[model samples]
Target: MVRFLWVCIVVAFCFSKWVDGFVQYSQRGDPKTEIINNTLMVSITLIRGAEAKGAVCLDGTLPAYYFNRGHGSGANSWVVHFQGGGWCSNITECVARTKTQFGSSRYMLPETGFTGILSFKAEENPDFFNWNRVLIPSCDGASYSGDSENKEAQLHFRGQRMWLTFMEELMSLGMRHAKRALISGCSAGGLTSILHCDKFRGLFKKSTKVKCLSDAGFFPDEVDISGEPTFRNFFSGVVSLQGVKKNLPRFCTRHLDPTSCFFPQNLISGIKTPLFILNSAYDIYQFYAILVPASTDPNGLWDNCKLNLTNCSPSQLQIMKGYRNQMLNLLKPISKSKQNGMSVTSCYAHCQAQYQVMWHADNSTLIGTKTISQSVGDWYFDRAEIKVYDEGCHYLVPQ
Candidate 1:
């Protein structure tokens, strides 16, 4: 059944602009009603603080977010999600991103219907339907970590300041009194969640229940098919360019290079806060963007396979299988954390928690009888014990 759905998804990937649509830029694209329900008025809050002095987007626009106040019993509870867009490692890439939604508030949508964990409907988001939800927009072109300002490039790489100011603003808005809090993100945003989990917990009282979730964010620091140090080189540039070494967790930086610290595999074991990692063994973005980037495949050996998985040769699939094994192996030690939770399944999709269809459906992405929504909800609410680490072939589900 999963295989059949995978075939359909591969067809869609081949026929449609799947890569463009799923890129972090769309801010978690889910099916939207043509008119965009007028009742859902999401006002944008611009940045403000001493740290935000030069904390602007790549396009020189102020960062913003959508805040939905909770009602009834959920007023004291909070759920904050950091938006995800791929990072820019160089001045050239950041300049290009400035023209797009990832780096410019001018391109962000004024009105967006919340779905997945942000869904107002109780059926779609049972645990957090009424929680005070905050969506932190991604426009820094970094994973919300950087403090350098480039006057010549006309860019303010102050993602760290932006994150600090954003959190401070949330605390001023009554989040300091939160009884239960969850910080989550997808893709680049997911990395942000992992990076700031302990800092977020520190903001609240010890009695407060604070946790984090990273969706499709466990990027492995491994070599691409071409055996080149693609991500290392890219991250090395980003770290040096953005002055990110000082911003990283000191414990990690003390042991490893700043670029290596960015990888979850190197940083996960040191995290003291409770965390939940939701990732696909065969993450679509990593496969194309990192594993076999255009630079690694100048001849386009993976062009057909990337667009349509069904077209992949046996050797290509073998490499992908190896990638899956690496993910599982990296996760082995983190699995022992009693406070941590995970759902590392064999799927080709990215950002599972953002879409309504993938979060929970009749044929939703799952490990055994548990769907992503069910497992995450249980972990968050402490309703049930969750230890899901499925050892099987990757599965695909059509949206």
Candidate 2:
């Protein structure tokens, strides 16, 4: 049994017109259809940034796509997705693949018709580029979470945080159409979904709603990625637990890490943005999984790939330990409030990007090792019992 962390892929390329930069993948779900059905994943390009069409931006063009399975038509709504990688380039290919697959929000909506904010990676300009699609401030990509702090690339770390804020701002800017607004992230990104939920809550057409599926963002409270353990990091160098206790009010889950919003803690009690959390049972995916699993009742967690990921590279193994710890710590109740209710309308992996679900040999473990408690399928309509599937490639069997 392998505990698969859905946070996974990437590569560097020349930013040339011939640079047809794109990612390819397939998503799986277990939906029960009356018969066999084929819903073509649609692409709705919300903002075609004129800059994307320029040579400076990319000798070719920057194309961002948001994939959707449309619903009934109305105001063209959107859901901005942030890909998960430890704010580094190690998994650039994986994250890029996702962006290429489902970057646009309106592409697959239930025909209710929606629009997506899209972007293309300028292989040369991974550091920065013009927003060719509707810039949701949500600049998507992954970064290395390694402890080595090279002075030359500190700018990348700084920009990672700022870009997350930028994406939330972008979502707020264009949230005028949707009936409600939601922020979702997987793995470390699951942390982003929580951190930005409250930040973007009131600014949109509706308050930010969150669906946290398998996440204990890198820093629940800021642990000095430099050396500090999670406890002290929560206090931002305040080594004294007494100091942390004193700052309990300010120490809410979201704010525990001075660097991140208290997304985990705030998602449930303090914030009104309804949140949904899913953790697998009998699985030790993260160090936190050792702390928190199905509890007495494991629900949506299909597989705990962390424990099973022994063969993962040193980088992957360490990532599993850190995130698992974050997940367990996060699973603990902040104020003791139960979730409002679970919804069936969930996307398994972070499919909010375009051209997602790349199940190639090198990265196959990234998806298959994880298991789902419920049946899985794809391109199907979801309602109250919407199934949120992550990783895993095989097309979902109609439940």
Q: For every candidate structure, what is the RMSD over all alpha carbons to the true structure, in angstroms?
A: 12.0, 17.3
Per-residue C-alpha lDDT of model 2 across residues 121-233, encoded as one tens digit per residue: 22311111112222122222321111111233221112233333344435444444444334544444555555445554555543323232323232343232223344423
lDDT of 1 by residue, 138-168 (tens): 8986688888878998887888888887887
The parts of candidate 2 lying over 4 Å away from their true place are 1-77, 88-174, 206-269, 281-335, 338-399
Give all TM-scores, in the order shown: 0.87, 0.39
lDDT of 2 at 13: 28
lDDT of 2 at 211: 30
The candidate that achieves the highest lDDT relative to the unseen native structure: 1
Q: What lDDT does candidate 1 reach at residue 358?
A: 73
Top model by TM-score, which number? 1
lDDT to native, each model: 0.80, 0.31
* 10 residues in a row with least lDDT, candidate 1: 23-32
Q: Candidate 1: which stretches are off by over 4 Å?
A: 1-41, 48-52, 391-399
